[model samples]
Target: METRKKILITIGDPAGIGPEVALKAFLQFHDKAIVFVGDADVLSEAAALLKLNLAIRAVDSVSEAIFDKGILNIIDVGALRGLSWQKCVPTAIGGRASAQFIRCAVEIILNGGAEALVTAPISKEALMLGGVYYLGHTEMLAELSGATDYAMMLTGGRLRVILATIHTAIRNVPDMITLGRILGVIRHANTAAYMLGIIAPRIAVAGLNPHAGEAGMFGREEIEEIAPAIEAAALEGISVTGPHPPDTIFHKAYNGEVDIVVCMYHDQGLIPLKMIAFDRGVNMTIGLPFIRTSPDHGTAYDIAWQGRASATSMAEAIKMASTLRLPTWR
Candidate 1:
């Protein structure tokens, strides 16, 4: 009985701060429409624990959602219906619940029952323990949506970065940084920049070694792989540069000198972004079959259910995805 297209919000891990922050975030959007695709009971528990003033309604499908300001319409996946949630830690039940919620959300999105997706955070360890094979959201979403060349792009204020590699061991990062890999990520970055309304964006590629490999003094990745990727991208009409000092490219991006930076690995990009927008950054998956965004941070198990988790990032994720269109991830 829903009258409008609703953006679907998936509560990540019931045991973490996902459910609590989800309730807090959606409450800020009185004018925009959204629906929760997770446990109705868990949402109720979060609402009661947080002293949130709102009406929670359970529905069987996306069509049953109602777009009212004070009422939250939820599709109860019931992964943890009668069980108690062990807050602030990883549990098999919590992991299974998280997987189910995300799987259900994918179905709704593919079926056109929703407009876009705003996901809460989920734990990789919990997911693997629960028999969900993927390491993180990007990998899981890529597989489920058939997204082949997808990349994780994080954005905050004027800073934006896409990772050449994510969710992998640091020891294995160097071996993975091939010319093809860097080029693919740069193309994804170009697509992402245009998606964000940046026409002719200055894309920067961060070097794998210090001082951008010091012109082969520190490493050859810059002289051989990184620079080649940048040149190839530029030849294809992308305003790209780099092999810049890994230490300074982020600062340049922060000051708006570059629109998007293709980082060599995970922490290289996230460390800088989180420092700038810890409570407001948005994690977006570029080249997905559908538009998907999430809070830049993960499920805060340390402060889970304390009602201390900030909802600004979650709200910002919803706001960001709500305005985006389906990307051509070719």
Candidate 2:
């Protein structure tokens, strides 16, 4: 009797490694309690291609799912049978199916059937081509769950980084780095820390400009916005620090000086995590009403369906999701 709420998984783009990795990871942690929100045919196809003979079954709910030694339960989200999808290539049909899977999973979790969500990798280009117009999973979940203030966080090994701005162009980043947004992300970072059961979390904020703007030499964003946000969060009794040089803040986090690093942009944080823990990193969305986690890797179109895609990240995402419950996004 595993009373812990089941983890809902959405196999990402049908044309990518999402299905293969998801099915592979599901086998690794099937006892953790999970229900796949995806196309059963796609899952079977991936299993066949990977030479896995695990029994895959479709159900309407967790209660209807028949979990056994060689069987995996899935709640099929799309009727994608007979569709010709190319492996390793983004297609509108695949994107549509992936989006449907995500939406169905969100609906199930929000309805109290599950406690957390683990999604496979998806391509933004394919998502748009399929007429599902959110930038990524973070955006899609935020809008679907009606969460306005949310931040994307990626954690692996000892490193956890939260993004202040995500899925935007470099030139547009400066404008998006307002004091309000930074403060929100910092608060969200704090929320993320609590979700992971960390108390009095040490918060490290990375500077936007080089050398932390060198005190307004390279850029004034640190002086005008980032620093102020940190100060404000601190005044509210949060153990917050920096606008530290981006080059060095991650090093400090990795060494355990800080519990989490509040990165100003996407690459500033991900580059370090992926460089080191790409195989097992977990991407989490903070400030959402329900727990949401995803593998930090993307649809590896280059190696899709070749059975070379690693399931380590996917397994890690499911394990993390199963452990963390929904927390207040304050």
Question: Which segments of model 2 are wrong by more than 4 Å?
Answer: 328-330
TM-score of each: 0.95, 0.96
**Candidate 1 residue pairs that clash:** none
Off by over 4 Å in 1: 1-5, 328-330
Estimate the overall C-alpha local distance difference test score of candidate 2: 0.89
Q: lDDT by residue for model 2 over 1-330, one digit each (tens)?
A: 658568888989988999999988888874677888999988888999989988888898987876566788899876487787777899898888889898898998888888889999999999888888998999999999999989999998889999999999999998888899999999888888889989889999999989999989999999999999999999988999998999988888889999999998899999999888979899999888888999988999999989989999999988888777556534
Query: Candidate 2 has which clashing residue pairs, if any?
Result: none
Which ten contiguous residues of candidate 1 have the minimum total lDDT? 321-330
Tens-place lDDT per residue, model 1, 244-271, is 8989998898887899999999999999
Winning model by lDDT: 2
Q: Assess candidate 1 and give its TM-score to the true structure.
A: 0.95
Per-residue lDDT for 279 in model 2?
Answer: 96
| Every model: Cα RMSD to truth | 1.7, 1.4
Please give the range of 10 consecutive residues that has the lowest summed lDDT in model 2: 321-330
